[model samples]
Target: MLVIGTTEAAYMLGINCQRVRQLLAERRVKGAYKDGREWKIPLYKKMVDIIPGTRGPKGRWRHRLQARPTYIHVNKHIIDSNRNRRENQPVIKVDRAKHSKYCHEVEITGPCRVVYRPHQPLCSGAVLWIEVEQSTRVITKLYG
Candidate 1:
């Protein structure tokens, strides 16, 4: 399983470290443990993406961005792979106010990986991100 530190979990969860620990303790997040020096948790990159936000897959992360955006999505079947979907979609962080439709806080069965790429107002009618699924780790890229 992929393990992450408290800081990383907090960053992905879009909250402070304290909150992350609380979530872990409460079992809101699965596979979390307290290390001798600190707490560690199993963080699936995809989980963070489903958290309702406009920040593209990178900004949500506290640290640096990965070479390619990485995260998992449970709604893989829902994605229409027949057409040229978001496969080569570029990621950008966006403001929730800008794209309320996609930015709304929605509940998901599990965390699915998604990159936050805020679309430029000049580029289109709304500010949203292009989502794509990572089939394998080799093809997937972790954000921060």
Candidate 2:
């Protein structure tokens, strides 16, 4: 076990020299002692064994991104209208329900197929239907 200074410890730990000194003062780093003005920290086999500090709680920033629309409303008439449209088709937002009980507005885009007749004005628990096309390579691999 070789002994190193604060600068070398900071480099190995991927932290600033000031933070390393602060950790030494807080007695967080094990087997580290102050010799007059300089501090000598003992090198360990792994970085995890060098410092045993408790981590902070997980952040809630990712929860914001996970927040989705309560309802996903897909209309047959809207898809029919855009069937002949160009590549850059504008997404239409549904505000009022014409056939279903749900009236909460939600934006819907892309092609969709009706799997079941009862799944009108889809809610959180509803099964969504999205149309997809099989590529030439995938078709050959499966059926060729």
Q: Indicate which candidate wins on TM-score.
A: 2
Worst 10 residues of 1 by lDDT: 95-104
Query: Model-by-model lDDT, in order?
Result: 0.41, 0.45
Error of 1 at 65 (Å): 13
Residue by residue across 1-144, what tens digits does model 1's lDDT show? 677687655545445777666555666556666778776666565443223234435333333223333322222222344234645322332222122121112333333444445554323433333332222211222233
How well is each residue in 28-130 modelled by candidate 2, as lDDT tens digits?
Answer: 7788888899888876663312444567753211111112222233554546666766332333222222212222233234333334535562453334433
Segments of candidate 1 deviating more than 4 angstroms:
48-144
Number of the top lDDT candidate: 2
True-vs-predicted CA distance for residue 91, candidate 2, Å: 46
